[model samples]
Target: MKIDIDYTPENKAVIHSYMRNVAQGNTAGAAADAAADAAKLYDAGSATVQVNSVVKAESEAGIDLKAGEVKVSTENQTTTNVSTYYKVPNDGKLEQL
Candidate 1:
């Protein structure tokens, strides 16, 4: 829930103007108006506010993890390669997959 602003020249100019207006003894009402407008322009026509959520489903029927696998679906994407890993054993010997 954090936003990072890349301060380009155009953005810097708008921000400076807004600050100058506030410092010039402007009315609180006008300053608030300017701030709202600046916020609109800053986020204009951008998908930056939309958030994507990941959902992990719980199954009612039990499944065996030892022999079962998971399938991930990404939008219009295909798998190129696959790799598997096994847990490291507490003993010196490495666990097999």
Candidate 2:
């Protein structure tokens, strides 16, 4: 459930690399290089993933059933004849008591 990550000292290395790249300029130059590093969709289908790309979470929302209703079939049988007492249907079929 954790979506965003907190910044740590490790981020400094990445920031430094970006600054160095900007100063030295990328080999491919600005226009020839990718517009931006496309964020990998967490769990999205990898049908279009590059050879070295790894995919995680997808764009679709997960299914939730907390508010859903489930149905079960039940039947009530007559129990007036106490001596000939029977019990509720074990196989879900109504039978006379």
Candidate 3:
């Protein structure tokens, strides 16, 4: 489904807050990660998204991938660029894949 988005001041404030928390390395809990992830998803553009597939990869860095695993795939209909992300169950964050 295509959802219309209105970039209001309040929304901007929330996104900014999430970015600040992420920059400060305060992603110890799932809230921070989820917020940051939402910001990133919004950045991806195009409200319509599809889960192409799930990916499982070995953890090279101990910082993002605490559980050493991820699951999820998305494709941007407008750009047709598939961006893969790693799902961290420990903190419920979608990291880079």
Would you list the C-alpha lDDT of every candidate in the order shown?
Answer: 0.47, 0.34, 0.49
Task: Write the residue-wise lDDT of candidate 3 on 3-96 in tens digits.
Answer: 2234565356645665666677774575757566665546533354334544444433323477666555444433333655544322334555
Candidate 1 TM-score to native: 0.30
- Arrange candidates by TM-score, descending: 3, 1, 2
Q: For model 2, state the Cα shift of residue 26 in Å.
A: 2.1
Residue 88 lDDT (model 2): 33
Instruction: Count steric clashes of candidate 3.
Output: 0
Tell me the lDDT of model 1 at 39. Answer: 61
Tens-place lDDT digits, model 1, residues 31-92: 78687755644452122232344445443444447778655443442343233323221222
True lDDT of residue 56, candidate 1: 51
Model 3's alpha-carbon lDDT is: 0.49
Clashes of 1: 0
- Window of ten residues with lowest summed lDDT in model 3: 55-64
TM-scores of all models? 0.30, 0.23, 0.30
Q: Which regions of candidate 3 are displaced past 4 Å?
A: 1-7, 29-46, 53-97
lDDT of 2 at 40: 17
- For residue 19, model 1's alpha carbon misses the true position, in angstroms, by 1.3
